[model samples]
Target: MRFLVFSLAFCAIFTYCLANRPKHDVSEDNYLELVREIEDEIAKENELKHEAREKDNLEQAREENGQEKAIVGNYDEPPYTDKEISYLQLAREVSDQYMEEIRRENEESENVGARTASDSLRAFSHPSRRTQMLAEENERQDAELETLQMLASGENLRMRNLPDLTAKTVQDDPTCNTKLDCEGKNLNLVDGKEFRTITGTCNNKLNYTWGMAGAQHRRLLPNAYNDGKWKIRKLSVTSRPRKKVFLPSARKISNVVHKTTKPKPENEDSISLGLFYFMQFIDHDLAKTAEGHVRKKKICCKTPTKATKFCLPIVVEESDDQFDKDDCMESRRSFVVYRCNDNVRNQINEITSYLDASMVYGSSEEEEDTLRTKKAGLLKMSTEDFLPISERATSLPCNATDVSTCYEAGDTRANVHPGLLTYHTVFAREHNRIAKELRKVNSGWSDERLYQETRKIVGGEIQHIVYTHMLPVLIQDSVLDQHGVTKEYDYKDSVDASMTAAFSMVYRYHNLMPHKLNLGRLKGDGVETFEQFNQESVFQKPSFVTRDNYDGINEVTLGMIQSQCPYVNRFMNAAARDLLFLDKNGNSFDLVALNIMRGRDWGTPSYTAYRALCGLGIATTWNDLTNTTDQEDIDKMKEVYADVQDVDLWTGVMTEKKLAGSISGATQSCLLAMHFANIKHGDRFWYEGSFSEDQLEEIKKITLARVLCDTLEDITLMRENVFRTNSDWKRCSDIEGKIDFSKWQE
Candidate 1:
């Protein structure tokens, strides 16, 4: 009691001294920091009093019960040590101080209003000035890719003016750029024409292959590793001791963080199942990383005693809810890229990184040649106007009788699920439809001209759908405008269009899938059920998509539009949580576990690194994760992870509370915004830039609803926003923004 009084007296004296000190003579940071320490001491004193009262209550309860037993059902957090209490105090101070900083800064904005929480979107207020700064920054900094290449060649490099970049190019025997590019073999010269190459090269004039197919994915932060080199980050990166902390087993983290006993709730946003799968489709189009040298199958589990470096199987402990005690989940590391003698490992992205419909048309010339018939500029169609049946021997993976159901597209992942196949089918049909329309106006055009023009149009329509229809559903419109993703972009070659590893980690949004895969049609509030399949059965099986005389396509299309997505939460659906990728022996891998392991396998940084990068401050303790989610989630995360920094990006971001007016959390939203913004501003062939104002308008008119209308023979009527369930249904003819191809006349 006396110590408390003396502490109060000390605080009074300290406050007086600081207040009387002139503002010009004192540092705001130092002042706030000292004030924070005083507040922390007060908080500690209060906690002591609270604990004394709780002890008294516990003693009274024990006396009344006639027992001296310890308290049960106490799920309270562990008592903090002195150091921990200090950290907790800093966390408490951060909230009010951070908010004040943002509010004060926001008031100085040119075109902004008052808002609480965060004033992060203020960067958009002066975009021209911002862009100039970015351009100037790029000019001053050497390209990271160049730096990596130079380090690979064992050359000493100063920050500025290194030797010719071409001297350090990888020893590729083929597929090199001509004299036009800064790097690449002087072998191929691709012209910048009306159409883009199947290979995502020549997108940048000064540096060809910046967004090229088969290039290495860019790293947003330096890769974290156990050995601080090629080894996966199986341990915490924290140099300071936090009570013998290490990264827990991925499976353990999964079972705890994603432990949901309640029935998984539907998305409150009412995002349709179609949009959920469309996210996967976008992933397939953008990044198709090459399969690892080692396969992710029975090899790792079978050879656990002598497992190679390439085989990092996920551990399943005795306490596992699903797997047997002895079983381990089969896993494989991504094929390591050849980055010379550098210890820092990197992975390869085998396809184009652009949001181009590489999923539909193929990213490489070889894949394009296989997909195209070179006849009338139309992609081949099978009987009943379905996607062409695959001729490749390995394409059909189902039972022999199900061969009839197998079909092909530019991306082989079309065989993975009905949603991807449905999307592939629609785009293939849309391509043929557009080619036929082009032939109507310009009969003199050759197959090459027709194919190129149609391809360009289809690609433009895709970019429009992703930016206009899909992104708005995922991110806020205000956010879109803030990030300049929705703005008219002038192509900037200075920007590196390569995707970051962080972006890839964010794309694993598998929790959005509902456990029961509904395949049916909806008429008003009623339903016309066709078939229902579980998650495991539909994978690698095409029969589900080709059933009922090919009515399955239409049924599944409607199923996607009508069914609601599972809400974005920590809960992994039972099917994904336990039944993912079942093998003949009844053993299966957990998707949630795989997501965590994969982030580590790729050497991606922990959640705190990305948070700091995205302007979400680095957390020193789990309590410091106040900006992330509710305390319940933080408690769950803290239970799994030993230290806050040990949490993987996939697990951390997935558990975050959704940002206001957005489906994703703040850090993820920022990273995604950065990605789309780069692709839009950096792409030489971004639709708005390549097309005339009239042609661009026609492109903008193409929405996802219009795409469905053109492709789905059975979809006579669909909701205006095909991605939204609450939208009004209308006949195909009544849908607005139908494409006008007359503007395409050259």
Candidate 2:
């Protein structure tokens, strides 16, 4: 009994030892190695199978041709058959399953000893895991095999193809040249009709390509709709059966879309009053559509009494009846018609689209000739001591109706406001400063060379300020990323950087205009002396800047920074209801009505189309607009339009909620992003292009604040954030943040 019991104990101990031993000693590396071996065996078997099939085909062909068949040579049989290949693939799958099981087991026993051999082996032998692994492995192997076969056979691999990044050339793209090559024999004529005569002589003709000092030529994009031929591209993605159906009456739109309300201050402070004028300066540089000479009679305004003819009467709602009954004009007293460029004879076309600072330098040769001094590349200036003197100076011609009222140089719209005149003066001074510095650096440089170089530098400065300082504040970071607006040094010629209709209309931020302008001076005692002027009084008035020995100009600059801009949504009563540029009788037109009409005149698509274009959800119903607009604004839209699709682009954008971290709504933000992106990416001579490393470095140092300090004579200190006023104003000299111009010394 003792012997039997001892034997039983020994047997039990041996069984325990076997059960605890490591199962097969398998690991991830070992499994991987086994898989590789199986893969090799399968490949070899597949090759042998291919050869066998080919041999059979050859034999069959020979028999059909009645040719004698050669005896087969004695060769070693393939190491693996088709069945063996299948088995090998199965083995690889099993190895994969074992690896997965081992991984799971290792995780389960991480803090403990190794699991029993029986349990591990059982998990590895799981039939379901083996079947799923085999299927996945087969699919992967088939794909890889197909790819390899395609490569070996020299077939085009679709997976290897990528987007072409080469610049498109004129040969391939019809819209690739600078010159407007007309189909007629005479360069000056278009199709039997005389082309618009070039106004200036060719002696100091501007270089159409390089924008040299004497170059007065402005070239349109080769494929631009208005490029000599009247081929205006339709802006709408889909055509409406009745074009007028898509277009709501401008007066009706103004009454609904831009109804005047109490003024609301913007949530954020205006960094600098200069920004308002700066935008205008930039706009002048970009676009100046010719005005129509013929006055077309149209009724734009309608009162409760009757619809009367002005340029077009603005329809007023009862809520917007702030105008005195006696004071209300039946028509727009001052009607300057917009010039037409298309066959329709109603479409307006911009004269200049390049960022060449044409606003300050002058758009045409004749204008440039009048502005240039022909000595030291200096611009003509007013002799009056009190006036600001620079290129694009506000100086009256001797034959002017009122010599006291100054005529603006460069852009025709330069005399739009005194604030814009201030910006023009500052930038013009900056150009002379740069020119003088460059002359000192290179004494042998001619007036032409000096002028062109100075212009280049000024353009660079403008581009830098816009991209670095202004854009970040205007657009959110996410929107910038979404639109790919980040700096790209390489030039992309394929990009058509022309301004779009939507961008032109949405950018009209007239609501930001304050009702009054403040003119103030920083006194010797550190106390500010301020005097307020009405918006109408400052229009086309540069005399205010010259009055009191130019103290008013200094006071105006100080006042601009001191004042806060009103909210963008609430148009001041002055701008929305009673904009200036009136006749002698003091009859005025509604600015909002003009903006809405301009959008229609430009043929911009309705709001819903733009929403779809911008990747936003289309508002089929008022309820669909909830994501982008306020509930009250959506309700207002519903009251105005029967269908959401009929809502105008400007109206929809204006009513939408401001995007997070941005002042404009999503649609406007998207449009701005698209426009700015085109400007940056499309321009070959972009400021951030592959110019000399040193030149680019110098250009980067030019900031708006630094430019202000360099140009402003009396102002010593200024705030770092020019857009907003500081609690305590700092002197320009005291501001440590000025850009170092010394790096530009060459």
Candidate 3:
């Protein structure tokens, strides 16, 4: 049993030893073979390392040689160092330094090579030079076009002296002085013709170009038109005022904005005050003249009524004799005519007798002949009644040089033919009545209120001008029924010498019409009453049209709103919801309101809107921008906002710049005219001066009100811009010249 147990223990120990021993054992021969394989790999690795080092060392040696040569070449000497030295030792030292440099250079070279390859790859992937060149060309062309437009729109006068003047010219020559010579002179003369008053119109071929384009003729605005009535000429060369204000440079004038002020009953009545000056107009004729030594003239008639009463100085003596006041002629019954509120009539009577006796004597026939001759020059009358005087000198004395000079001293009234003056007087009377009615509504108003009211009236006048005359000119009579272009002008006159067109060619384009592109919101059902307009409610109404329909809709209809409303700022964003929003592609899309703060890449009409919002103050500063990822840019914008506020504070700074004087009357009138003219003609006039008759009719489709609004707005802008630019020029100056210093009647 002991022997069997020993066997089991021995077996267990043997099994444990076998389990712990190596699974595969090598003999000396196998181990030697493995060792040889390991040795071979180590040798190969060392060989590679040695080869790399040798190559590196060779490169270092070569680099060291090059540097030594460069150092010698650049500095003319080797740098000295403290060391035990020999030629080989020096070479080895230089080689060590160069080896490090070579290593660095290799790294740098690799880096540069990689960068060049990367750049090459990128260049290959990018768009071609042709595309870039084309883009550049397009940009350049766009800039040029913009510059041209800006130049054309600028305030500069193209005077008659310029070759481009489109007005008809009739040069006055001395040859056409005889009655038979008058046959060739252009005039509206007929034997025994009853004189009728007519307004003078500018007759220019350019003005009638539309007729040539198979469009209707355009007519000049009436003499009563504000722009027409007031020439707004540049101050005479001698009348130029000092542009700099007399006030201190830093001085600021406090502004007072009157909300509402009523005229007091105790205040002097404007009418009564105005009538005080009526004393200058009493009739001196029909007075009793005593016989012999300078007769003292007696009063013609007693004052009829308090309203019609006027103070007149009794003539104490005649020109031949000085004497005391005369009380005679009390029994002389006076035939009198008292026209109610006849300012001009009284004025004429006050001065006419002086002309009859004192200024010129026995010269009525001569005066009539001279006036007839002058009238012939105006092309409105004939010289048949006027005797030709090739060389004439006036011998009339008593401070009178001739009929014309005497007439001028009487305020151009006497020189103007009786027929023309009669018409002018009638027109003036009507205009004054209209002005008085306007004053009733405008009285006690602030400057802003007055400006707005005046603009509205002006707008109405412009509408009448375009619709009544200009439209007919643009669309010929044949097409008048259809309101389109046609090749016919029924109203033939000598003025229509160029038969190619019966209308003003300028109006024969879409840009010339007032209704072509209606941009105002006051069209259709949107027309608001005065009250609604005054309130904010007008803008609050739903927009019937939007920018998306802009191309298709009549832009003229929107002119009022365009003139009044903020075009592209907050209002645009607010209205964008209703309007069809367009992208650069003209594709309709939803506007991201936040993008306004982000700035637009495309045109946003931002400047126009800025002008409108200037009075509204709807914009916010950087502090107002919240949750913006870019805070730095926001901070900068805050600075810009402060500058903008400063600009608001310095409203008159522009006047200081003399920007007002820089703009001529022609510019102001042209701007106003173009605003309407563009609407009537369409887009052609926007960029070019040429237009077709079809374009003109398209313009006629525009509304009259919009044209007026645009015109008025342009005038207002011109005035404001001029004032701003020449704010510095505003200074204390005596209101002399033709301006009456007397307070204007309400």
Candidate No. with top TM-score: 1
| Tens-digit lDDT track of model 2 for 500-612 | 55666777667667777877677762436368877755655556666677665567777776676666652334543455443344445566656665454444557777887
Residue 151, candidate 1: alpha-carbon lDDT: 30
Per-candidate TM vs. native? 0.74, 0.62, 0.14
Candidate 3 C-alpha lDDT tens digits along 1-746: 12222222233223332464333333433432432333343334445454445444434533432222222122443421111111122223222333343345434433111122112212111221222232223222222222222222232312111111111111111112222221222222223221110111111212322112111112222111112221111121122256522211110111111001221121111111111111111111101111101001212223212111111112212221111223111111111111122211100011111101111111122332342222111101212111121121111110112222212111122111221122222222222233344455546644333322222232233233333433332223322333221222222232322211001111111111111112333333232212112111111111211123321112222232232221101111211221112222222211111122111111112211232222322223333222211344334333322322221111111111111212111111122233233233321111112213443333333332223223222112111111011211111121111111112233
Query: Which residue pairs clash within candidate 1?
Result: none
Candidate 1: C-alpha RMSD to true structure equals: 25.6
Clash numbers, per candidate: 0, 30, 64
lDDT of 1 by residue, 120-157 (tens): 11110111122223222221121222322223232232
User: What is the model-wide C-alpha lDDT for candidate 3?
Assistant: 0.22
List lDDT for all candidates, in order. Answer: 0.67, 0.51, 0.22
At residue 418, what lDDT does model 3 achieve?
20
Better of 2 and 3 by lDDT: 2
- TM-score of candidate 3 to 2 decimals: 0.14
Q: What is the C-alpha local distance difference test score of candidate 2?
A: 0.51
Using TM-score, rank the candidates from best to worst: 1, 2, 3
Q: Which 10-residue span in candidate 2 carries the lowest summed lDDT?
A: 161-170
